[model samples]
Target: MPGPDDVSIRNLTQSPVPYKVLAFYKFADLDDCETLRPELAQFCCGRKIRGTFILAPEGINGTVAGTPDAIDALLDYLYGGAFGTRLAGAEAKVSWSETMPFLRMKVRIKPEIVTLRAPEANPARQVGTYVEPEDWNALIGAGDVTLIDTRNDYEAAIGTFEGAIDPQTKNFTEFKDYVATHLDPAKQKKVAMFCTGGIRCEKASSYLLAQGFEEVFHLKGGILKYLEVTPEAESRFNGECFVFDERVAVTHGLAQGEARLCRACRNPMPSTRACGAIG
Candidate 1:
C-alpha cells in the first residue's frame, strides 16, 4: 500500500467513461484514493452528480454514475495519473436504462473492496484454480463434486447450480466464518464456489484451502464471464443473474437484455421470486 504521506492528485484521479464506472484493482497505495475522495466529492457535488468509490490498502472497487459530460471529465482527471493507472483494465460493463441509477456519490476508505473476514488474505496473493464453464459442466456432471454458492442467501434463492449448497452469508465477509464451522468431515470431496464476477471466489477459495479442504475450485470469471462465453441454454446455470448495473437481473438463458433487479437489494430476483417461500 502507498504511504499515507504520498497521497496526491496525480495518483487517484483516473476515469475512463461517462454515465457510470465499475472497477476492481489489486493492492494499491491507500493514501492516493483517500486524498482524492474529498476532492472528488466536491467535484461531483457541484455538478449534481453522484459517484461512489471504495478504497483500501487491498485496492479500490466501486461504481459511479452521472451525466455524460461530467463522467467523462472525471475519468480524464483520474486516468491522467499513476494512482489511477491500476484501473487500466478494469471491467466497465454497460447497459441502456432510464431509471435514476444512484442516489448520490460517496467515497469512503475501507479495509477491503469485496470484504472477506480474513484480513490475512492478501489481494496480492495468487488466486485459486479457475474452472471454465465447459469444465465446470463436466465436473458437476461427474457427480463427485460439491458446488458452493459464495453469494448471500438471497442471491442463491434467485438461482444457482443444480445442487449447490448455499453458505447463506449476509455478505462475502461472513463467508470465512461459515466455512470454518460447517465443512463436512468428508474432506476429500472436490469443492467449487462461484459469484457474479470471479473476484470473490479468489478470496473464498483460498480461505477454504487454508482450513485444510483439498481439491478446491471456483468458476473462472464467475457466472458473468460464463454468460459472456457459454450459451446459457446449453449451460446448467438457471434463472436470472444479478448485475451491478441498472439493468438489474439478466436471464442467463438469453442474450443480454434488461435485468429484473430486486427493488429491495438491486440483485436480480428469480423468475419465480420464491426466496425461502417468501409468499
Candidate 2:
C-alpha cells in the first residue's frame, strides 16, 4: 500500500494544481510539546507555509498548505527527523485548491488536538477497531452495525454516506451527550463511526469503548481516504464532503466539488449561490 506522502504526491501531480493542502493527525505521547511547538512553527514560518498546528501532551493535529516541495520537506522532518520519535500512525489527506487556503501558520499548545472534553477519551491508549475504506461498505452494511457520523452538524449537512446517522452536534464537545442519549449499547450491538480526517472519530471511538459499548469501529482514514479509493460508481456518499478550507468540499477522486462556504454563516452554499453576498 502507498504511504500518505505517496498518496499526497500522486494527487498533487495528477493535475496542474499549484497549491496543496495536507491535513493530518496522530495520537501519541509527547513529553516535549513545550519545546517542539516553536521548532515546528519556525520551520513552517521559514518556508512560508500557512496552516494551523495544535500540540498537546496527548499528540499533534492540524493541516498545512504550501508548494509540493515544501510539504514534502515538512513530512520528511516529521517522519524521519527528531520529532519522529514521539509520533505514530500519522497520516495526511491531500487535496488541491486554486489559492492558498490559510492566511498564516499557527502552532499552539492546546488541552487536546481534537477536543472531546471527556477525561476518559484517550486515543493514544486505546481506540476503536479501524475499518479499511474498501471494507467499510460491507461493515456498515451489516445488519447489526450502527453507522454514525462523528463530524459537526454543518459538515454532515452537506454530505455523508447513505444510511449513516448524524448526531446533529454543533461541535465535538457535545458528542458525549449525543451518544449517551441517542445510542443504547443494548440495542446497538456494533457501532461504526467516522469523521472528516479520522481524528475526531478516533477520540470518539475511545470514549464509546470507555462507556462500555462493545464492538466499536471507525473508518481508518475517514471520508477523505474513502473518496480517494472508492470509485464514484461504487460510492455510497450522497454529496460533496465538506472541508475546512476555501475549497469548501471535495468529491470522488479528490476533485474540488461545487459547494462554497457562505460568508455570513460559514455554512456551505451551492455553486450557483453568491457566497460573498450571503452576508
Candidate 3:
C-alpha cells in the first residue's frame, strides 16, 4: 500500500481537475457522529469521493476532493438536509489540481472534531477568541504580542508567520508543557496563539486563559483561512501550508514543487524537509 506521501505525489502529477474542500462545525448538541456517520459514509461511498470527514459532538470537520460535478452533486446532497440545514453555509474553498489528493474516504465519530486532549471540552460554552487576518498582521508585528505556533513542530517549520515563536514540540501535549515552562509570565495578556486549523488554538487559548493569561487571540480559521484572505504573493508564511489533504502543502508564497519532501524520509514534503531520513 502506498504511504500518504506516495499518494500525494501520484495525485499531484495528474491533470488538473476542479475540486473543492469544506470544513465547518456547529456547537455540539447531540450525538453528532452517531447521527451523521452512516449517512455521510453512504454519501461519500456512493459518490466515490476520497477524503476524510470527522464528526463529533462539536460538529464536522472534513477535507474531500473530487471532480467538480461529483463534488457539487455531493454538496447539494449534503445541503439538502442530508446532514441537515444546521450545517448550512458550509462553504467550500475552491482549488484545482491534477491529483486524487486522498486515497480513501473515512467518516469517524469522535469526542471533538479536532482533538486537544480536553476531556471536558464544551464547544458551545468556550470558543476561542477569533482574530481576523488583517488584525493578525498588525498584532504579529506588535512588540508586546508573543505569537505561539500551536501546531506540531514539523508543520510550523515549513511555513509560519514572521517572528512567530516555535513551541518546538512533537505534538499538542508537548505544547502545553512548553507553555507552562517557557512562556514568559509577564507576556500573559500580550500573547497571541495560532495553529493549522485554528482548532488547537481555540482550545489552547481557553487553556491559556485558565492558566492566567489575561488576554488571548487565535487565528479565526487558523492558517488555511488566513491564506484564503491574505493572498498567496504577500503571505509571511514562507512555504506551502501543510494541509491534512492529498496536496500535503498548499504553496503559499514559495515556488511550486519546492517544499513537499520530508527531510528525514526525503519523501515529498510540502515545504522544508526537516531531517533527511531513510525512506
* TM, every model: 0.72, 0.92, 0.80
Q: Write the per-residue lDDT of candidate 3 for residues 1-279, one digit (tens) a residue.
A: 222222222333333445545443444454656767888888788877878887876666777877766666666666554455555544234455466778888988877776667654444566557898767887777887888888887788677888888888876867667876887556555778887666677778777766667777888767876776687666776555777655667664211235565546533454333555654
Ranking by TM-score: 2, 3, 1
What local lDDT score does residue 58 receive in model 1, on the 0 to 100 scale?
Answer: 67
Candidate 1 is scored at a TM of 0.72
Residue 78, model 3: lDDT of 60
Summed backbone clashes in each candidate are 9, 0, 15
lDDT score of residue 237 within candidate 3: 68
**37-69: candidate 2 lDDT, tens digit per residue:** 989999899988899999988888998898877
* lDDT, ranked from best to worst: 2, 3, 1
lDDT of each: 0.63, 0.84, 0.65
Q: Model 2: which residue pairs collide?
A: none
Give the Cα error of residue 119 in candidate 1, in Å: 1.9
Question: Per-residue lDDT tens digits of candidate 1, residues 1-279?
Answer: 232212331243343423433333344555666676677677767766654777777676665666555555555545444455654434333222345467777878876777886855654664557787778888777677778889887677666777788888888878877777778537646888898777788788777666666788888767765765577667788766665655556555323444465555545565554333233
